[model samples]
Target: MVILGLGSNLGNRAIHLKRAISRLSRGSGAVLHAVRLSRIYGSPALTPTGAPAAWDLPYLNCALLGETTLEPGALLRHVQEIESSLGRQDHRRWAPRVIDIDILWWDGCEIKSDDLTIPHPEILKRPFVLEPLRDLIPDTILDSETVEAHASRAGARASVGEIAHSPDADIDVSYPTLMGILNITPNSFSDGGRFLEPETALMHARRLVEEGAGIIDVGAESTRPDGATIDPATEWARVEPVLHGLRALQGEVRSLGRRDPFQISIDSRNPSTIRSALDIGVDILNDVTGFTQPEMLEIAESTDVPLVFMHSLSIPVVKGESIPPDRDSVEFLISWAEERLAEFDRRGIKRHRLVFDPGIGFGKTAHQSWHLLEHVERFHDLEIPLLVGHSRKSFLRTVTEKPSAGRDVETLTVSRGLVEKGVEILRVHDVEGHATLVSRHHSDRLSQLDAGAAVKP
Candidate 1:
């Protein structure tokens, strides 16, 4: 079954949405099983420049469930076509629209691409989404925390009056327990240009696997805040060798008796890159952009690949030389990221395939990173798997009184702490050390559980 979330805040909002859903139901290879409407939410528009601007419109949201033979991406295109027919195009950032049809989740599939990101990126943050979602899936928990807990944190600033779903269908997803960070830039402060050397990158890959990494991430560009930027060709060059090595490593690891070692993730915000990676054997995509761009969601909706939809505070450059990452902006980093993540979920992308990240050092100060970690559990309510890469990060060194290059112990220690806070992946250089520690601890726990279950039972 696929869940489609609908929204509108323009002329004949309700009618526009009805026409869109009706078109969807009457369209090909899809059936409408359930529909849920939340109380209309009227709030000022949120512009890219970070001010409460006027959309001169109201927003109405709803949830829908159905089964479809059309692949998730195809279905997404179909939805976009409907929106276009209903007259929705780029006018303003949060300007009113006639109708928006977003596929939140497609059964148990995960997709990441330029055109679409399943689970609609904005679902997590908007009360407009959660309210209707709760109406239908009251017992369904999307975050690690319970639904009530997730709701309570939503506060009253956002208004989403609860509406009802007619004979609500069962919506559920069992998430995989793995997260992989794919940093693409050669200048990413964390890894530097190490992965640029394919051989050296393969070594890191091997170490991750030996250390219990379930996925090997491949990035072709960098999004480090206030960090050096590169062109697409440059980004491609950086990741191409490593990507080839990664594919070969798949076979190499298999030959070494570690079959199905780990999935490969393409870390990129560019749709072109997403297309290029998928052309190869890339298994997943991790986009740092909030997926506010309709094209981004369009790319993801066009495929069924797993996606890691991140939360960032700002709208990234569409196609320009972005200024380097901010080295000393904590609130700018955390709050922006928090809002981005929530908005991304609200827009599209399912909660299951959707892994969240706390941007760590990107656009963040060292102290901010520490504060984010301190309240990292707050993100657990999103229910998506968390990926924190403190490996050789400045934060690790800050706490350890060492530089980023010589802080393996600090990195490992932070990794341990983050995992306890529900982080699923630790993107780091010292994978072997971290993996070995985690594996041993896990092994002992299993042993203890086995011993307890076996004795006199």
Candidate 2:
């Protein structure tokens, strides 16, 4: 395990840092696969006592935890080459540069050499380093104190520098993709009986697309614990008309000169319903059962659409059930996802088309669900896109005490956190609210980046 500290203060700092990360991940002959990335921290640049005022520009800093096959010396040389490629020049000490990558820690080894140092000598004194390091490993013991403890102490010092922007303030970053929910069932949890009619569902689908949904995940069966269990025929009956209506709507949009409009996804576990939806034309398949059944796998093998394999212990999700207490939630989830990926690979399904969902509120206690949200970054190690559907679920009620309809505020709040943690897609009910949240966040990030770029050295 190695932790590398990255920072930049000149010429679009976010871009520099991102480019450096990309280069580092592809080290020549020595693979450096980043497993976890800390939240990007913006701090005032550190300069020498007699340095020019122009050198004190604010910098975007972050730490990356990764695994590598190279030794300390080779790794240092590799990063130095990456730095040179990214336009890093070492003309003077503490000088502003396009990129800076330092090996912070390397497999708990303590080494002192003329070229490199393990456990960076100034790691404890620099709050910018500690702040992001704490995000990756809060409880790591350093200098006989936890990283979190050191961060707190360094943070209290007035000279440590103020945080200027949130982690998502990057001009080149991809914002969270929105998956709009269209429930055709009359007993769905959040909007049950609201859009049961085909016309109403079609209108709502159009509204969702207008509000910024890249995909509309249409479901005809309610998967809630106490919800009714319908047969494949009943499910298809509810779903068929909506699919046709959506296709017609797509045609209408294209006729009006709209090209490559929103995608359509079927959110059902029933094999019959899945086949019918795919027969008509659905861009994605969202299996709440995680494709455990042979028929579901057969359908997956037949189609090339992206598959959302959500983790659930049961279909309806028995109430009061949760992952075993002895097992770690994040580890369990990653393991389950890995197994699914392996299964898909053995069956000749392209692994790249798979997306994993933690299945929040399904067979999980409120606390367990919240814990998964807090440590959501761990799932990124799977190297697959993630989709989270925490929209107005029972978990939010644990804190907001609001019913399904009233949890939009809480839903938006949690969605923001999830976006910050770098989740790829968000399956949401309130498309407008999530859309507004995403738009505002992107606008703020652009403003910050613009301000940073305007700074003259």
Candidate 3:
């Protein structure tokens, strides 16, 4: 049994809910069981009303119940389609929405995916949703706490009430983590061909480890939009030097003074390259294939290691250094990620061992990138820790009007926003600068948060 809460503040709110439930009942993947809706709650508009008549526009909201066999992600897509069908446009941020459907509970299962989070985040913060949902699933126990108990304990009517994941769900990723990037091509926008020399590459590898990189991502094949592809041998040659250098550093760390047993990651889509890296001792495979490739699944499961699954519009030519997303974007990338994660799970890939990357700067316009960053919190719903790799992206330069040749300062602006959103691993080339900025700002933010929590009336 699953409990879904639905609401709409736009055109014909009640009608939108009715149509949404009807469509969900008949959706290709879901089964509509039963529904218990709350009395429609009306509230003043949150977005400032420019027109004198706009202030009178009140928002309508409600809740629901159902039984379905669809996975969390599949259910999400169906709901999104229903919302769109009911006249919900994915254009506004915090604007009037139509037929917003949220998964309140699913057969007592806990799920966190890139696009969908079960139990619905913000459940503990919205009395409008929780009050009605509580009436429907009167005895729902999430994480050993009753829905009523959970809702009552938290301030459901707080000013900030938008939920990103279920109240009981876990969204914490390892914070202050490190991710060292490797670009295996002669023309990557950043370090293109600079590390081609085995000696120079080895030095870079050692330096990254010394500074503190929990995972070293070695890219043997660069997949920049319309980027060049090489044969298996060429791919292997590029990463081999760096891989060997990492091994040498591993040994030296122990002999000299430090040893973290840092893990090594192979960033590639070719099964052969992945297999070869595995044979030589790679710990993680960052597959941009979206796990659509059968070989990717086989190699990952066979190795029984963790995998970093990244989402892309196409398998190639992520956002070029030439183009980017725009402002006020509506492309909900996290929601999309949830759907992709479901795809991986259906293929027998373990969710716990999987890490999520929002595929920043890949196929996303400038607006899309901002939407991801602004709501990076929404991704915490996936539960698995996340990695952000938007360092020196063209979008940053385009937005900040900084030159892309080396926009370290401009890129840092985005990084700052991400860290505030609780992003775990920051994939970057400027290790020292990132660490410095994070170290300085984290203290202040932590203190401010603590003070806010302590000042309760």
Candidate 4:
């Protein structure tokens, strides 16, 4: 029997442990079967005097007892790969991490190598590891004492408790959420002039919510390359009626017993339009222009709502003179986004409430847009949830010989890739397709969790 201790002290601790367990169950050189697992425990930080401040966070630790055909050294390599895949980084000892996996014991076999040591040197002395290991393997003997005895002896020194992962605990990152597009403008490239009327727009918004859209992005003006921009007053007039209707819909959904109401986002760059939408209580502001205006920053400072700053070299809806010379699209995007984010920091906007969109088709050439999508994971360094609006953009049109409406398949294809790369919010035109895809993905994870939870002592 192989036993591994898993722990995480940063960023959704429970999800990290569960994710590691799930990955380990899959093949890693040799097939590994999860024989039994222990309940997740929240433990106090193991901070010595010389530990860094990052070790201040508490850790969620658990133990997994499994059967594997691979030898100890090979298994150690596999576990290290899994840790790095789940966002663990090389940092100082006792530093907080996204996930940490240690080979507590391997088949009662003792092995020593430069890279790893069997029966972890201090495993018996640590209550966090011993407690969970004892639960899975009740009679497990470590060093000269039984697992239970070691845990009992050190239990008084450690603060630990059983905890389960919430259904929505990993909602922000584990699963890709669909943000349905609700363009209320008459000049938008897709769905423009379709739902300009208040009732029609409201009906479509309701349909989006019913179809499993976590967010409904109601854009007043078109941000297409060849679209025209209206003044703030004209823009607000277009979206005002629809906003009022959706505000009422929010109450209706809540009265009908929905716990977390669907979020509504205003997709515009004008300060006046943002102010009007905020006055009517919009949940998020998605500025395609990166929120560069002084008044826009002022509004962000005064409001506590989440804001999305899309990366674009020029203002939306207006065609740029020419595409920039070929270069590393990921580097360019990161640099541009970082500079914009620094401005937000100076404006006193909270980083926790900030979301970054890569601006798929805002101003880039067809090649540039595809390059950005291909390497979307590069933006995870921003350390926040990413919003990808790849719903029927010009990039798809260039790849496939299809019109705007016919590119839903391409959009779905890209959406699946983004979902796999940990893209959180996907703004799409086809809510049902994206929602169904994400729903099934989340369900598979849930099933794995259910199966793991069933593993007891």
User: Largest TM-score belongs to which candidate?
Assistant: 4
Candidate 2's displacement at residue 128, Å, is 34
Model 3 segments beyond 4 Å from truth? 1-174, 256-259, 318-332, 442-457
Name the weakest run of 10 consecutive residues (lDDT summed) in model 2.
448-457
Model 1 CA lDDT for position 104: 76
lDDT of 2 by residue, 307-339 (tens): 999999887778877899788888888898889
For 1-457, candidate 1 gives per-residue lDDT tens digits of 6767777765434434544554555322224433333323333334455534556444556666555777776776777776775568754546667676777765567778897886667767866566555544555556566544555566455445332222111100001123344454456656666666767777777767666566777775655545555667777777777777778877876787532356788877777777777787787788777555677788776676667765554433222232244543434444554665565557564443456676665545566778777767565444344577556765565657766667878766776666554355566666567656655545553353334221000
Ranking by TM-score: 4, 2, 3, 1
After superposition on all C-alphas, the RMSD of every candidate to the true structure, in Å, is 18.6, 13.2, 17.3, 9.5
Deviation of model 3 at 55, angstroms = 65
Worst 10 residues of 4 by lDDT: 164-173
* lDDT to native, each model: 0.58, 0.79, 0.63, 0.76
Question: For model 4, how does the per-residue alpha-carbon lDDT over 117-147 read when each residue is reduced to its tens digit?
Answer: 8878888677778767766665667767787
- RMSD in Å for model 2: 13.2
- Given candidate 1, what's the lDDT at residue 74? 73
The TM-scores, one per candidate, come to: 0.52, 0.64, 0.57, 0.66
Query: After best superposition, candidate 3 residue 285: deviation in angstroms?
Result: 1.0
lDDT of 3 at 51: 41
